[model samples]
Every structure is written in structure tokens, then in C-alpha cells.
Target: MQTHAQIDGFDPERIERDVRRWLERAVIGFNLCPFAKAVYAKHQVRIVVSDASTERALLEQLGEEMALLRDTPADEIDTTLLVHPQVLGDFLDYNDFLDDADALLEALELDGVLQVASFHPHYQFAGTEPDDAENLTNRAPFPILHLLREDSVDRAVAAYPEPDAIIERNIATVRGLGVDGWNKLLGD
Candidate 1:
């Protein structure tokens, strides 16, 4: 697959490194997503650094990534993180783009097979303030379109006890950590 590093003057390797650190330290270390640790440890997570500077370009890349994930076996690639640092830097813009991301999933007829989850540096929920500690749960090093297999999600949720409590547990975890603690954890 094309890294598109030359297109936007972004160093894909560096971007991938930063993302990996975030995934390992913030996501896995903190247990934000219980399902993440196993797939990551198994080397089934694919991180793609996109150089797309426009929403259109990024959307196109998203479609391709979704198809690739659908076609690939679960053992080889359980999930993908498409990190697009150039486009949708603003959280508002990034939030709006998620609708289009979902639409693209329907268009590709992969709606039931795959799903998209969002993570951004400034990810604020609808009711929460920008500085709310809970938002940290979804925050990442950059704007990320996390693609996953629906069947995998089902299996994980089924295996984990009280799967519905994960969100509240995550919020409490980050709230306890607070902003400074969170930054320290991420080595920011």
C-alpha cells in the first residue's frame, strides 16, 4: 500500500512510531480498550499513516483500507488504524468527517462486516467540556480512523464480563488519572 509520505511531506515512519507509542502506552497500558491488547500483542494491528490533506482523499483511502481489512484474514490483520495527521486536524471537522466515513462504509457494502471508530487529539464528547478528563479515553496522538471487524467485536464483547461497563470504567480510569497524569502516562 502507498504510504503517501511524499505527497504531504510527512515522515510516515515517524508518524507510525508516534502512533505505536500511543497505542502501546495510552491505549494498551491503560487498558482503554480491553480488546486492543490481545490483537496488538499478536501483531494483528495495522497502522497506516496517510498523507491525504483533504477530506475527499482521506475518504478514498478509508474505503481502500476497509476493503483490505475485510479481505484479509483475522489472524493476519484483526484491525487497522488509519492515522491521517494532515486532514481534519480540527476536532469539529474531524467529527463531521465521521458521518462521511460511515456513509462510505454503507457505500462499500461493508457496513455489517466492518465498522469505524474515531480517535483524535482533541476528542470531546457532545456533553463534555474540551478539558473533560473522560475525553482522554478517546484521545490519541493524531486523528485516527480505527477499523475493526464486527465479528471480532462481538466475540470480544461476549467473552468479557460486563462489557457495558467498559465505558464508565474507562471514564473513571482517566478521570482518576486527570490531565497531568494522563500526559505523564503518554510521556507527552
Candidate 2:
């Protein structure tokens, strides 16, 4: 892995801070992911800043992240956010790359053991317009590959009253916030 200084303008600390803001101000603040607060407050969420500029490089980093997540204990790390700044800037291109991520998990035989969730600045659900407020629910400051443990997710879902409602709830929350509210929350 290259040092932050080696990767042009790739400041891991800054990236981490930006992610934290998203988590605290958006995720936790809006209660988008109900289970996020516990892991975040416990400091179990791992934020990995990757400066990979190519698909191959990003995949290599993804391999390493999967290995780390598999090897590490749950107590030490419950989840990980693979924040890649250089690659997959275009939402459509990034959306396409998710297939590769799934394939990698399947190839590694971690399909059920691990799940990959996606978040991007321009996250747009299928059949939704670009300006739709519902899109903000999955939108982030940058492209993020959220690696989660199936066991943890299962537990969280089991505890959650209605896991399915999360989407509508998030949409409603963002809609209530509106564009100005979102901009203010993002400190834009």
C-alpha cells in the first residue's frame, strides 16, 4: 500500500474525516441505517482510504480489504468502508463495476459470508430521475464500497423492527430535508 503522500492529494486522514461527517451528519444524523450508530459509536467501523486509479489496482485493494475483513475479529472491526477516490468517478461506470465486485465475492467463496453495499455521490436508483430527492439516500461525498459481515447484518436486521422500511424512511427523511437542508447538512 502506498503512503498518503505518495498518492497525489490522497489524504487518508482527510478522506476519513469526510466519511465520518457523512456517517455522523448524514447516516446517523438522518438515521438512514439504523444499525450504524452502534458500530460507529463503538469505533468498530474501519475506514480504508484507497488511492487506486485503475480498475486493476482497485480490485487488488479490494482483495486486500476482503482478506483483512475475513482475518480480523468482529470485535475489532465490525464493518469497513473502502473509500476509493481515484477510480470509478462516473456513477454509470461505478454502477457497472458493482457486478465485478459481486463476482469477486463469489470467486472468493464469500457470497454469503460477506456482502458489498454501494454508495456514491451520484447514486441514482433505476427508474428514478437524476434530480429525485430519493437518490440522496444513497448519495455520498464520494464513491464508497461498504463491506459488511453477513452475521452482523443479520443480527441487525433481526433486531430492526422492519428492515424493509429503511428505504422509504430514508426517502421520506431526505424529502423532508429537501435540497437546502441537505446542502446545509453537508456544509456546502
Candidate 2 lDDT by residue in tens digits, 91-151: 9999999999999999888899899999998899999998889999988888999999999
RMSD of 1: 2.9
Task: Report residue 151 deviation for candidate 2 (angstroms).
Answer: 0.7
> Candidate 1's residue-wise lDDT over 90-136, tens digit each?
99999999999999999999989999999999999999999999999
* C-alpha lDDT score of every prediction, in listed order: 0.93, 0.90
Could you tell me the lDDT of residue 112 within candidate 1? Answer: 91
Which ranges in model 2 have alpha carbons more than 4 Å from their true place? 1-7
Error of 1 at 170 (Å): 0.6
> What total of clashing residue pairs does each candidate reach?
0, 0
Highest lDDT: give the candidate number.
1
TM-score of model 1 vs. true structure: 0.94
lDDT of 2 at 16: 81
What is the TM-score of each predicted model, taking all chains together? Answer: 0.94, 0.94
